[model samples]
Target: MLLKSPWKPRLADTEATVAERLVQALADDIAAGTLETGDRLPAHRELAWALEIGIGTVTKAYAILERRGLVRGVKGRGTFVAAYQARQGTLIDLSINAPPPILSHRALARSLMAISRKVDADYFTLYASPAGHLEHRRLLARWLETLGLVADPARLVLTGGAQQALALAFDLVCGRDGVILTERLTYPGAITLCRHTGLRMRGVAIDDEGMVPSSLAEALDSEGTSRRRAVYVTPTLHNPTTATMTLARREAIADICRLHDVPIIEDGVYGSGTEGTPIAMLAPERCLHVSSLSKTISPGLRVGVLLVTPAMECLATTALQALPFSPSPLSCCVIEDWLANGTIRSVRLELKREAARRSELAKALLADRTLVSHPDAYQAWLPMPREEADMFASSAASLGIAVTPPSAVMVAPEESDSGVRLCLGGASFDDLTRALSLLSGIGRSTRPL
Candidate 1:
């Protein structure tokens, strides 16, 4: 019988260097246990031949793996697998962008236990309407009062998450092969969703205040009045580039969208540190607003609400049904309790304070360096020399800290700002401080790429 091949790499072809790709291949295999603990990787010359790449690239790949402590160079004995990964290292995760859980597990458990006793068993077991329970939506409207919007429960829909809300909004606004207008740098979730929907995007340039209205007006005019174009925006604490638009800027964008009769999708997920009313409030007739508790409470709740135009309300309901919407009764019950007992407002207050503190910490840490962020934002954007961007990010990842790459937030390749989005949430205050210190140092180094 033929022997099993020695460490064949099924690497995905991409723009990443051959050596970087090779390291990723080995790392993935090691993670999957396909490459056993003691099983040696193929020799550099052999791997190069197998991969049909230069032998030098394989050498670099092995060196990178050794640096990450995933393997070892055994001198004359040849490089051998050392360990799957180093356990001693403290991986300060600044990658994931989510609100840190401010509530203790014990407190949350007590709340859930109390809720179960109060709620009917059948109510919790049965599926809710696609738009969720009537009372839950009324509470969602009342909750919006704090944010300066007086939404009607009749025009609202409950979604599993902001992503679901956004999906339905995209589906309602755009058709097959539709085009959406967005800021040059926007949310990655929307970017990922558009890829699946065949939704083409036209990017508008932004200034310190936010997406330039002139840029948006020009793009809309170029697309013509009859074109099915929808504009998506994160007005306050705009993702990856914490550039909050002024109220005037919001109105300017509203006028342009209204003039062209284009629908506006307002992503209000990060409503925590935002100011003024949502853009939906500015142009209620043509806007679909999405808000979620994921960034405020816990993602486990998976609760989201949409403020859609009354005429377009059924679109969301229909889209939710098509997606087989089933809102989590357990989570809705938790929201009910939290909203009733003032727990939601208290948590929001605490998270707001925490967010401000973290933002200040980041600013202070990188005071000498360049960082674009709002005082209340959860992340800061760092722009880098285009040529140095690749090495800078690769180096940081190699050192065990994570950040949002520019490619993730950019819509067009030409709009790719060579930088990273540094999220301030997720990690503890201490871990954040340490990570920021290392990041500041790494960022200061102007070494050749």
Candidate 2:
């Protein structure tokens, strides 16, 4: 009897598109002498029907193989195995959120030298305060003011990175068996942190503006005020999906949270090049704003700043002290110098232009696809059927380019996202263009009705 076909894939581990997986399995079968060079594969719809998958998926897979010299199609006769050629090159990464490195080396060098000359060397020898140095905190307070908040030095807590800052914020406020409410889809880090801490998280419904106020109230009311610790949000240039909550939405959210005595954990990591009034500004007593210089500056620097009110300062600092490491002294020195001399300000302006250019490139290429993004945001979202998008993303990965599948960032795994996040800022312009070109070709591929 003929060996059973290996085209049926366990997708949880497979990185090739379902169609590509079939091509690959067939190729392997031919090499192993299970199928000869002259053997004919199953007809497209017949094979798709057998696999219980879409014929469009099968068509896309076959098209790719035909172009790569792995298969040949005849008008009346079904497709047959052909010679396959190996592809080469490093994988072009588009899966990560890291922006293209654009820091001025000269500026960094000058800042380092200035720190050594102007600042006392003794400061470096001592451990920084658990929260942060007073002067450094003061400078950070001034920086926050530009964002529309009148920050107090005591209210600011510095951490290694925004991830750490967020962890601390959650740890400080959340007790055991607590539930943290958040937007249905949110930053991946928050989901991981909640799982690690054994804290339950319930996703609230959201519209284009952001978390629906009614949904927020209903979730809070159901959970009761006692076990609900906080409501986390990415108010500006929200990750994966660029949903910036309007000022009115922010106020409405604040009102509901305040009524339930629920604190807000606002993430602004992607806010460097964008402008939006923060939730913290509207309800300082109820919000903790978290941000970093990673996307705007160099990720290598690893400086994150947290803004809280004086009433919450002690708890925030206690959480800060609980960590094995406080803020890095060197990173602090760099941040302090950059903030004081207006270097960071100038860099942000330049980076803002770069982000806009990258975003435009994405819009131009994927205009036909369902896209969700901001002009100044570093990533864009494309809505596709969940299985189709997953298969497409895997094929993109197999072709040596990486794109983030929606499930990676989904807060509720069972709730379907059915899309991918195309990170525009991670690669250089040329690299981004090429990857996007390949991606667009996939979109432009003809689909079976």
Candidate 3:
């Protein structure tokens, strides 16, 4: 009879120590879901002998796992999955894009309260018109001026949020079967919007600087066959990769869009933190800019401001007709009061401070590791060795940390890479710090084959 081979664990070439090997086995089992929540693991000596490792190494590995709260040891019984193990799941969530917690500012809170007192009616009673409050539009215009994007308050339209703004823009720009050009790894929401509307979305190549000029040119050249209508971009402080294109690249893209007679929808959601004139400032005549108070202030507000060229006012108004009858008047009033009374400025300063702190923490934790991010960005892009992105994400999840592997944010479903995006801005500083600590440990820990 043939003898069954002894149980063996796959180990990375760089990690040869028996202690690292044992840790790898535990990590692999956890990731594979074989050692599930509350599942009792084999005794230390049994596992060590089965994997052909020294008992001392097994002891050390178990000690490390215990410290991380992955397993528990009892006086009379063998080690088992800790009762608290379920709480240590996933970190570094890259799936959802969320702003950091708004640092509390007494002045802003007082201002909002003051506004609420003067409104006479409850917030729900005021949001009956789709055009939003007139005062809110005026305040938004003033804020736009500060950002160097001049606009007339009469032309501004408020929506639920940036996604709503994009949806409205789509309703105005594309009819049934219309086509739009977008970067290969563009925001997923845009893709979904096109799909829902029966519109076609064509992907264009992008370089480190952003969407390549040549790719846009190629897509535009196929006008008769493809009939590209609009182009969308996240120009400054871009999502996922955190890439910020230079003025020269922006001008080139603008010129290309102008040449092709295509409208450009610029998502300036992350631009508030960056100090420079927006691409909208350069091509306001042909660009439709969508911005929000969520990233800079509070997402719960759900107010999105749309800035359009004077000639496009009618289009914007018509598009707004298809959306909810009106935006929340209370949200607009609060934003208006915040902008006019200097509360917005105070809130922005708080955001900058928090962003700076989190960015620094991320850099410190991932030092010597390859990460692409901006000091003010809410997320970081990590390129890992081999195709271990999924494995790393699974390991992090088992550790109570959430992350998005490359497949989650791919521009083209066919394209693949070994990278993941880690968000740093969504949790409290203490929670974020703890998550980062766990992430750093994983980065330093051994990987299994």
* Each prediction's whole-model lDDT (CA): 0.77, 0.74, 0.70
- Please report how far candidate 3 places residue 115 from its true position, in Å: 1.6
Least lDDT summed over 10 consecutive residues: which range in candidate 2?
Answer: 6-15
lDDT of 3 at 259: 84
Residue 44 CA displacement from its true place in model 3, Å: 30
lDDT of 3 by residue, 350-402 (tens): 77777778888888988967878787778887866423554566457676677
The order by descending lDDT is 1, 2, 3
Which residues of candidate 2, in runs, are more than 4 Å off?
A: 1-87, 444-449
Top-TM-score candidate index:
1
RMSD of 3: 9.3
Regions of candidate 3 where Cα sits further than 4 Å from its true position: 1-94, 103-109, 120-129, 223-228, 384-387, 444-449
How close is every model to the real structure, measured as TM-score?
0.83, 0.81, 0.76
Evaluate model 3: give its TM-score. 0.76
Evaluated at residue 149, the lDDT of candidate 1 is: 75
